[model samples]
Target chain A: MPETIRDPADPRLDPYARMRERDLVGRSGRFVAEGEVTLRLLLGPRARFRAESVLLAPERWPGLAGALAACPAPPPVYLADKAVMSAVTGFPIHRGVLAVGLRGAEPEPGALVPPPPAPVLVLGLAGLTNHDNVGAAFRNAAAFGADAVLLDGPSCDPLYRKSIRVSAGAALIQPFARLGPGRDWLALAETLGLETLALSPGGAGGLDGPDLPTRALLILGTEGPGLEAGLLARARALRIAMAPGFDSLNVATAAGIALHALARAQGRLVPRGPNRGGG
Target chain B: MPETIRDPADPRLDPYARMRERDLVGRSGRFVAEGEVTLRLLLGPRARFRAESVLLAPERWPGLAGALAACPAPPPVYLADKAVMSAVTGFPIHRGVLAVGLRGAEPEPGALVPPPPAPVLVLGLAGLTNHDNVGAAFRNAAAFGADAVLLDGPSCDPLYRKSIRVSAGAALIQPFARLGPGRDWLALAETLGLETLALSPGGAGGLDGPDLPTRALLILGTEGPGLEAGLLARARALRIAMAPGFDSLNVATAAGIALHALARAQGRLVPRGPNRGGG
Candidate 1:
């Protein structure tokens, strides 16, 4: 059952207030999940993060009742009319579903990487400041069965609301960790015994070759000035072949292509089960 | 010589006025091209569209002078300060570059598809209304050396400003044509003599198999609700291999992966020359 809240200023709804402004800053130890798909993922059985609470428009209650009921210890549900919900959030709650998710303690980078001989595929992001790219990277990583995503210090937070929405909620379920600022990600990959492949337009060769190692870290950087010179120098450099005189694909799109190709080449992709979604 | 404009309401600047509102509707057989990269592409030698005029912040002039000068019978250039430019466009022109491009006559779908015996890769988009996705598809198609992009009637216009910017100017240079509303794109593909492969979550098999034909049309639909059943039934259905329960990749990302793979499979991708951009 949902507690009906009439006032926008209710202290209980503080977490959902001024969302547009709050999105630019930290949510303390929490993050907001928006839309039905993402909220469902947060409350679903496979969720890695725990939901603190859920806010919903009255009309959304019926559709979400089952998922809410399925939670082991369901979070409190607050129901509001569209006007009050919009007033509280400082924007129209078009999807009519939102949840507050707890971030918990950060996972150690090494723990996210599986032990050797396990056919590992990890996506490493560097200097990716765009939330959309970070989210899309996580989505691609999960879609291709990459064990985890490791982000360098300069990358944007995948938990950002827009990213979570863009990722199709993969950021909530995918295993990920971030390296400390200025930390040597390459040295860490070396210590983990994972072959490092950096993607660049000027990479040594195309991505289709069979030489891709079974256990590898595919590093992606921001769109324009790609990975740093020192990082590209140490890792095996790979390029996606392109027509003459064109710029590269958007960074996230490139990550998707690289992850799919490398995952296929290494035989890491899982065969589609009959009951699963078709993509 | 560039004409200096002090007033935002000047009739000569009408094509650039109230850009945000005008973007929602058609531009009277014209399109807005934004950002330095796209402007350069519009004025470049290979551009498929012609520029009617260019508006620039004073600071952007020195850098773009060469490209502007190179245009045969170069379009008139309007110079304005950031303040006047922002007022005219109804938003801050952060990139400080804007141009009005003529759409020209719509090319026939058959004309855009290369005649038989040429290695053809045509991206067929269905019901993709998202400007960003449409733009990204064009960028991916251009990057992977797809001969052209064919859009069904339900798809959005690719010449929208945001689409043009997202396409990295591929929308200006890439050969593209749209089928009339309610037209069957698969029938057109059949007429073009290209094998049709539609991407879906429930696709018959994964995209990795070697059976993909050299000359093919890869069809992509919107992210959710994928391609319509009638269309999917008419074409060979294919899916990107994914982790068992994950949702499909974003349509644009899927297109990038598919285009890269099929282009490589068909030997249509051009090798990186010594001097081209590295992406």
Candidate 2:
């Protein structure tokens, strides 16, 4: 059933109001999608689950009504006037639609990638605090055949509107989990028999010459401050070869190049299901 | 000269206050940065100019006074009480210091890339609204041998605090300019006699090929919509050779891989300087 909301102070909008209070729907365990395009993409067959609730600017999207009827289990769709919506969201609702969902249980680290022909790129959350990096990390993780992404230390939530938007919904599709701090992540990768290759430009060896194993965990830190020194000491620091007169690429971009090279070296391509869009 | 700010409501903080008001600040060309490390990087040798003003917390650092003394045109550093500093910034100023700088001038479209003995990897601004992508593009531009960068319409400013921080301060160092709609950036590339290659997975030609140019503009768009159909129609689409199984890498990561591969093909090595702190 669709409910029309006329008042900004309505009690039914507690979840939506809470979302406004926190600047996002979920504080730690929830993800939110804004805009009809992103919502459509998330609700598409490729996503893991249906949205918990859909908030819409009634006047902006006249066509959304038919679309909602088509969903297998149409979640609650909240319709509000643009001004009231803006008043609650604290900003003009540009997208006119927002979808909220739970942060599903993350797959166990080893479960993301098997010890086979495919190499898994494990992005280590080093000193990166930017939400965009975290989102881009997920995007790169999906692109480079990383089995899953792990995060540590004040990293942005993948489900955050900004991160999801930045990742182009790649964060929603990519397999990711938080492994907490360095010690915990290192031990898990070791137990999984993954060759942990830490990416650092200061490393003694370049990425190409490394004697990496088939099941490699390519650990990367945020830019500027690469891997934590202790983390670097624990993992093998390797450099990605660059063009003459270039310094270093962004961390996510670096990961992409490394992943592409490694994937080519392994001679395998990742396959997206039927829902894989144009690419 | 440095000033001590004991009150949060001091009128001097008016300019800095715009940082939080996204719409106003986005319209006005201004951004903010905090922390000594970020300030130091932003103030490196290649940095064009000093920030407008700085808000600092007292007694946090005894040694920083010497560094401030060395600036050619030192900024207005305000030593504020912790509570007062937090009140003005609308967030806890953890860096013990906050610096506000006027966004620099945008570069002319053609001026972005330098005359190349070095190859230029130009990141196309096609419907990329995410600030992170803008930031990542700068990071990639610096990592690759791109002499300059160009920004198109509806794209976020490279100097936005999010972008500046995301690019690891590369946005300041890299030569970047902006272009308005209908200017036809692809046409400009053609006029510049530079090979224009748009990164698209749909392209028939693989990225690692014999015909790769020594000097090229590697353009990329936002994730979903990909490249604008009009622009893509004009520019030749080039796909990065990926493992058969993967769908596609994140736009930034793809650029990274392309930059690495193309740089190698062009016989470029990563430029090294005193500032190559890739930890």
Candidate 3:
């Protein structure tokens, strides 16, 4: 049976308390997952996270019985009424599902990255600091079969609570790591044998242009300022041929398009499922 | 000269005040624009919205001089310091750029949709109620040059503040209209000579599949409970080839990918020129 906590101020609930997302992220490698969708993702087979505990609205406790029973070793599940939940979280959590999970030790960026002469697709984020964008990129990376994602500062933490929710919990499952406090992200990618393709609005080659290398690292920059000039200079600039007059697609959307194209070209993407939608 | 208001409660500023986003959206056609990027888009030359009034943080007032001067009939630009801005909005709006714009009268859904014989591309929102998703759909519509967007009942307002912001102001300029509250959305598209291709995870045809008609209406549903069974039954199903294990892409990203493929197949997308990225 799960624990029932009538008090909103239980000291054990600090991880799911009214702390800001920024403060909660990357703090001793613990993170919060919001909503049932993300909670399910956290327990996905490939997730590199361990649920420390769950704070669930009472109504949800029954519905989650099957999921709980399936956990390798069920974590503690705390039940709270809506009023207590509101008081504890500083706001109403409409979905009423949140879990605090600890990330397993992730390898250094250098280790997970593939070395030269290998056919691979990897996504590298440079100064892409919005948590939602980072989360969305991670989701897209997974969708398109990228090997992993590497981020360089000052990028927002993908494990930030909102990011975890936004990427639909892809940030938790997708293999990702920090490149560092200071590193020539592009040079490092090249050393890993990735031919960097910097996606830009104005580029020298269309996404469909000649001979996209079998081994590629697609680098994206922040939305507004875009990739740094030096990074743009180092990478072979590639553009998605968009309708004229529009400057660019949203950074995350751009990533989806670019990743889809590159993934297909490198023979990574494949059509999946029953392959039919019918009543 | 822009109006300088010492009072946040100035009578002229109600449009920019703390009204609920739900109440403000489509209330006599007025909509809020948030952030610097969207405010600029609202003032773009081809915009179909009239700036009713603008509330600017004191710091941003100077940088916007050129944009303000260029308005066809510049709306009152209300200048308020951060404190006043916060008190009025009941939150610290870090960007300090918010404008209320009134949309022009819209054409009927029937009028904007392409006829059977025309070469075209369009997006349809069946029940997409999330403001961000709706907004992103509009932004993608604009990016790929879709003829228009159609929203059926139960969908959120595209003019909602967050939608407009997420759309990068695409909602202000992209042509969109509500479909029948009761009529079959799919039947209406078929009648319009559009080959209705519903984007679904279980879709049979690869997005790159042959004979993607020139006159096509790609319909999308909410992320979770996708297109209603009846609607899915009435349309041909289409899918994006993605890596295995993932259930689906975010609605917005899915829109970008689907739209890109459909648009390209219809010869609606042309890879633009110069193809150059420089430091």
Candidate 4:
């Protein structure tokens, strides 16, 4: 139900501020979402919420609350002035809305692979601390119908507020998992029967190599370092076809272009099937 | 040219910290490039610059300052311990290197557009405060061989630190201009005889519209509340051919895909021309 909150010190709005503190959020297992648009976008079918809360301006309550009222949501909606909202969130959120939803449950990696095997763009991010790049990768992964995204060692938290917003809520829909670094992750994927294709700008072969495999994993590393030498040596390396003067594409853009190439190679992104467009 | 700096409060490093304050950067006409990778990338032919100062680890001086020493670089490099370097820039300066370069003068809008006949994807962004998206747009613009990028209204500063890094220093090379919002900007574009294409999920025809003019301007808005209605109405609206269940692609990824489509339409990004492998 909707509730008006006059005092900024209200206990119900505690989760909003708690998310900023690493220790508190880690213990509580909560994340924050700012603005009505992302909140609305995340409220689609198949959305599984663990905890959902909204801090809204008075003018925004009617329509926003009504939308929730029509749904099966029993989450709390805290109404407050813009200043109070800013005080609680630690920033001026002009989006007029915020929601703290539970992180969704992910399926086993085995289930994500398409039948008869379509090429998968596996973004192998190691030490990629920037939340925006993480989010942009998820958005790109979803746009090009990547089979799944596997996070390698020391990457930034994908559920971080900035990542979610930067990803435009794509993280909520795209399936991803932390597959820690080293030989074990590669071993597990090999066991699953997926060929690994690591992206290297200096690699001998272009990304559009001959005899496109139906089931392959495209691995990517962090921004500057490119790819880990150990991992690059283990997996088959590929390079993007580009003009000479250009050095390299941004990791996320390269990921998008790679996804497009692999999807087209496997005929996965072709406009067909259900009237509903490709996700 | 590179010197060791033991004191964290060294007065010479003020310009580095000054770049941190977003407001002061615009007023001072200065910006900082962190890491040896980006700083070197920014030192290319198209990137004109006069180094105001540089901060680097003492050990990196010999290897990193080679090209700078040959030129008439007035700004001496300031060396500091890892801890002191971390304190200067809000985030950890991973490569133990940083450089403060003057903001090079931007060319006039008319000068950026190639003299007719060629395909140009001029990204007109409005209300996109996220620096990463701006950077990603620059990255994509460069990847697609866009003639130039034009900014209007209140958009994020391209010179912002995060944007420069996210763009992989492409912001240093791509030509851009800040034109205020009005009919004049559009009129000037029309005078150049460039067909303007506004990207919207709900825009009229799909992304692969018939025979798009070779020279065109692709206007992209922030994630939600897409291109302003007035702007969309005024330009040719186009939507990407997306699958069902998918709402929209991240603005940058969408730009990459659309640019790929547009380049394909214009026959620019084909596997030919100067891209012949191996010298």
Best by DockQ: 1
TM-score to true structure, per model: 0.97, 0.75, 0.91, 0.78
By DockQ, rank the candidates, best first.
1, 3, 2, 4
Q: List the residue pairs that clash in candidate 4.
A: A207-A239, A276-B244, A277-B243, A277-B244, A278-B243, A278-B244, B5-B79
lDDT of 1 at B95: 76
Model with the higher TM-score, candidate 2 or 3: 3
Angstrom error at residue B259, model 3: 0.9
Ranking by lDDT: 1, 3, 4, 2
How do the candidates rank by TM-score, highest first?
1, 3, 4, 2
Question: What does the lDDT read for residue A46 in candidate 4?
Answer: 39
Best by TM-score: 1
Docking class of 3: medium
Interface RMSD of each: 2.9, 4.9, 2.4, 5.8
Question: Whole-model lDDT for model 3 versus the true structure?
Answer: 0.81
**CA displacement after TM-score superposition, residue A162 of candidate 4 (Å):** 3.0
Q: How many times do residue backbones clash in model 2?
A: 17
Each predicted model: what fraction of the native A–B Cα contacts (within 8 Å) does it retain? 0.48, 0.44, 0.51, 0.14
Give the least accurate 10-residue stretch of model 2 chain A, judged by summed lDDT. A270-279
Q: Over the stretch B72-163, how does candidate 1's per-residue lDDT look in tens digits?
A: 97999999998999998899878789999888899988988778888889999988999999999999988988888988887888899889
Residues A1-279, candidate 3, lDDT per residue (tens digit)? 888899888987877777564464455668888888788877667777899998888999888877888888778999988788888878787888889999778678767766766678889888887888988998899889888898887888888877887888888778888886677767777678778888887677777665998888888988777887788888888877666665558888999999998888887777655744541
Expressed as tens digits, the lDDT of each residue in B1-279 for candidate 4 is 467877777888777663456544463578777666677766545665666777887777788667565555446768897778878665566688787778767677778887777656676666677887898888888777777888775778877878878777777777788775564555777988788887777666555456777888887888766777777778777776443454557777778777766766676653433322221
